[model samples]
Target: MRCCLARRRAANSPQKTQVSLPEMKEQLSQLIQQALDALAADGRLPEATQPTIVIERTRDASHGDLASNVALTLAKAAGYKPRDLAGMICDALPASPLVSRTEVAGPGFINFFLSGDSSRAVVQRVLTEGEQFGRSNAGAGRRVQVEFVSANPTGPLHVGHGRGAAVGDSICRLLSATGWSVASEFYYNDAGAQISNLALSVQARCRGLGPDDAQWPEDGYRGDYIADVATAYLAGEKIDATDRHVAGKADPDDLDAIRDFAVAYLRREQDLDLKAFAVHFDRYFLESSLYESGEVEATVARLVANGHTYEQDGALWLRTTAFGDDKDRVMRKREGGYTYFLPDVAYHFNKWQRGFERVINEQGADHHSTVTRVRAGLQALQADIPQGWPDYVLHQMVTVMRDGSEVKLSKRAGSYVTLRDLIDEVGCDATRYFLVARAPSSQLTFDIDLALSQSNDNPVYYIQYAHARACSVRAKLAEQGWDWEQARGIAALPRLEEEQEKALIKRLDQYPEVVAGAALASEPHTVANYLRELAAEFHSYYNAHKLLVDDGELRDARIALSEAVRQVVANGLWLLGVNAPEAM
Candidate 1:
């Protein structure tokens, strides 16, 4: 087992600047490389026996602060047993202030036990960095376009759309924090059979025909919101959506005018729904624009020119199997109208041409079939696009539960729960947190009762309350006629000797790594999970300790720790697009 002793620093004295976890990891990696170089120079190991060193925090405190498997990784390469190699590497390692000691454990794992001061310095670092604490420049400001919540403007957004908006927007925030220049785009499927059905439904409603009426279109939408749209249209309401403005014609007989009006009306409704949910898109690219600009046709011609397309049974098909699709897919139908996937291919091709080297599509898992077809279409174009050109984050279904049963129907939508319904019931913070608190690929169960709870059962509430508790400490200090000295608290950091204090500092140190990893993996849930865990740690520590103590040095140190906790909770919640309230 590895153990480290606290190195006492002058209480209430000025200290040097703090190093972040990534910087410390890099420094440790350099030290290991130095050891490798020494081994090479001593002729015990081959020259340039350098491997990419991976340093990870030890889950168990007994194992040490950080660990590496470099020895086990390079053991075979050096013709030495793993344990023997670890000992040799340890012997060769130079002195460093960051690591107090090194240990060769089972399977040749090299564990570095950090000095107590180094471990506790995270509190000072968190205080110094504040809101910018967890952010990093890992992306190097690369341009990344994230397309999400492109719900067809046929009806109001449903619960599934809520998940996509929350997850997708959080992803953009994550990428931006990691230094990526993120562009959030929403692709409007505004020119398809679905939109045609929406127009027919609205026109039928305008003609005083209901779903039960025999004159209703077979594929007409049955949502009560459709009736609302028709009412607004008959009123000649001038509706302005993000992309266009349409004055309702008030002509029940004009199908063309009704189509335009209905699309605009529903698009505006979707805009309101997303706005109420606190989601925004940088651009709304319309599917009709693709057809109007002839990109769809141009894409089809290119596929044919590349010989990746064929004509059979009076339809044009792309040999999607050439790019790993299960089979070929139809590009244009027998009646000359293109299929939905063709428009998708054109849209992505436009994305590539616009200089978006990285494009991520966040959509429902129901679009799984399109992933292969879309990629295959991109490949068949003979474009320089990679095999998996545009990436996709497909989220599974969301089931909203209330009072022990599934809440399936919404009065406005008349079919499924609307995103606005959830937002109105629980407010935006709880809704956003619940929607994104799980991995995208996992099925999520949103519990309305739990989200509204004031106890720890509510994750959003619990996390926010921790921040609130930390904030209350300062208020209490003020109430007691005591002021906190930040420099004194940092200098007195060595006074925080409790296991809980140590644990909280260690957790705070892991934030930047968590943010970078979550951004890279396109997993916002990782940050959500970390916030919950960190909140739990803070709550436990706060419960066991008192910040407004009589001892000035100890009080300052505890206040500093609490403030650090507050800063980190705020930072993590900000990344998830959720708020961390100073008071519950």
Candidate 2:
């Protein structure tokens, strides 16, 4: 366990420098295409033929840095064997300082060995960008919005909602790091029938002291927080007039009473819990607010103009099928009330109105049926909504377990484990990490025992330990007369050359790649897995060698290596909303 947490640094490390080259990979890809074009241009190949370069990692280190297969593609058209085509392409390659050597081997595969300068430059890039390395300008400063964990205000967030929170939050963080301006949103379900019932539930509970088995609505909330919310609502507020207790009486504004009760009750409770769980939002978009703003009316009218909606049976229906939905969907039911889908489309239109180039809705598992029509409606009204409107992400369920048994989690209308409950048990860092530790599409089983455990066996603890170890190493260095800010007088890291040291260095070099891959995939779990792997590498290095050595140069070099490690671990954990503590 101790070994898993140790973070060994290298002193007398290489001098850091920045690499500002623009689109090196893209340029390399284009050059490979040129090589294929050369085969055709030289009349040594067939007419107008183009075979793509397939560059990727090599299994054998001796093969080179990156391998490509442009030759195999040119073989058929050139009427020559693959190896012969590879030879021609290699001979015609342009000179580059980035590539020290290029060799053709194994069925016409072209392997290029990157110059040591490029590899060394990667270290500097890590130092310069800190945690923001590998972030892309692909977004080109596009404004984006992410709406997530909008679980109705009727109850506390359950286990499943935790997954959406982590996924959505991490996606927002990744996008912002990559040059996209991002806003995190929560769509409040504060104006629905279910919420109305919640107000009445509290009203009923307020009239009584304890659980009333006789009058308790079966479909209403039964969570402990329900009682808690009820208490908060009753505190210091007078309830003198009682129509229900009288002989068959009614409050004139009964529906309004219920609506008012639900909204306030949920807002207070959710606020308390959201803060406790550290699931924050920049804005809480209310469905009622959209309705009040006439955005819904505007959306419906625009849909009609687009010929996507028609009146039938005194109810408005959107021709979603025309936009690829299986069937036309009702905007308002025959009962003269809007279907759930109506406001949903209106919400997305509002997202577009806010000038977002892309909108991502991180929805729960249950909303599978609703995603299609909302997208279809947007496509139907593309003239009104900006192009490339929105993308929907449906995450699967999360199961909470303890001691190998499924914890009882019955959302009985509004009864279940709140986000706060999980936080109280495992803490915010553990909760966030556990939420994103699995694939979003795969049903996740969160082991309460594992997350809350102090043992390094827990991946979160292991990562945190690496961060803490880095800080400790730095503190000791500070006790001596060294600071990471001072440039290394030595040309480069020397004598930190054991396998373990190199292993840790390699891990540090790959941070940008890991971050870039995670953002592209829209999978934050990749970051979590990366931190764990990196921690293991650093730990192994620390345990095998003594960084605080008798030799000053080697000691300084080791500390420099550890300083780089600390920066990365701290940055990665910060992106995930996990702390990198100086001391455990």
Candidate 3:
């Protein structure tokens, strides 16, 4: 991403600023699109009007920094051959100092070789923008709400939830980094049967039953934290009731005592665990609150009033099938209990009502069925959403491994590993990176051995080490009494011809485009991949180039380049909540 550091403070946070881009690439892409459209009109090609012009780096430096495959992609439909079309498209390209030459490569791929001057200009933008590298307001004024790690307040979050935590959190950061009014929320499931079971299990434990006791439901939560919570609640309750003498009134103190103890205990566990794994939530929305406000009932009533609900078998059923659900889902079950769907709809509706134009929910793939139902409900009650509504992102599961064996995570069985346990074993940075290293849609095996492996095999540590090394270089620069602030600019940089430096700079240049593309596509995992790739480029650059040369201008230029690399690494890690330490 091209570094341009123009940023505005986040609405809710004073510590964080939202980055805005310089809009150079979008301008360039528009220009290229126009060229393609013009070429098609000249009858040199068929339908080049809407081409997927990918401006990417060519493997061969002889080709260029930004390569376009518009000509090659249109080859089949366009009567003209690939090379002929490429030539025509080349002829149609707008004249600009940014683009030095356009060449047709293997299979008629049109590659634009940009000038060093253009690359130099990007660094100047980076220096000028400071910390807003790769920022853009493409989202304009739209509000986007990202609800993630909505882990039911059942037990401590597990290693399996780590990926969703990392992915969802990173996504929110990416959206916020752009110009979206992004709100991060953690959906607390405090009302479901899950919570009821938790309360029941705590009561059972209060009666001094074993964790494996039959009184504990077969499907109840079984993590160590449950026992801890139950023990703490019981101790606090007995201690409180014994000390208080309320004649006839139910002491609100006792109720609060239990709730506060439980919430505080669990909150501490979450903070400690997430800190270990580097995930954070901006807001925690309690499910009970939604019910308390009668929003859930109101939503159901509104749906019924809209003819989007029907009564069947003495139960309220949503006509979700009308809007693409596999079948109508029960809004309220025959037992007179509302299903999770009802409250979920109301919660999201409340989010939209709170002025968020877009609501994004990231759930585990196990919630695939629920996702469908939720989307269906939203579509059935689409009238509720003024414009943009809730979008469900169902990420595949993450399985944990220890010494090459799979660790089962069944929240229902009352036996599983916690996210805290994973961090205690592998550290947070590794945990976060490993989860986000892959596409969220792809199920990943969280291999403990691979993560702990000290070799370059550990990608998270590899990236972190690169950052630490860069910082160490800066320290070295300071120790040498070199003034980093008064460093020479990129133009002062020699015809930077080192294959490694050129490659790193090229990768850096692609950052803005990747960020914009990812934000527009609503695919934040792309940013994660881009980070890993950028870090790798820096590592390669570090290993190959000697930055402390005697040539002052070149040395300063290299230092500036390294600083930019460090800035990006820190920015990426900041999004992930992973530290960019001065030393490993």
Ranking by lDDT: 1, 2, 3
lDDT of 1 by residue, 267-313 (tens): 89889988888888999988899999999989988999999988999
TM-score of 3: 0.83
The lowest-lDDT stretch of 10 consecutive residues in candidate 1 is 1-10
Q: Compute the lDDT of residue 258 as modeled in candidate 2.
A: 45
- Name the best candidate (by lDDT): 1
The TM-scores, one per candidate, come to 0.93, 0.85, 0.83
The parts of candidate 1 lying over 4 Å away from their true place are: 1-16, 33-52, 74-92, 106-108
lDDT per residue, candidate 2, 494-558, as tens digits? 44566566556556766777777777678888888889988998888888777766566577667
Q: What is candidate 1's CA lDDT for residue 574?
A: 91
Most TM-score-accurate candidate: 1
Instruction: For model 2, state the Cα shift of residue 319 in Å.
Output: 2.3
Residue 93's lDDT within candidate 3 is: 79
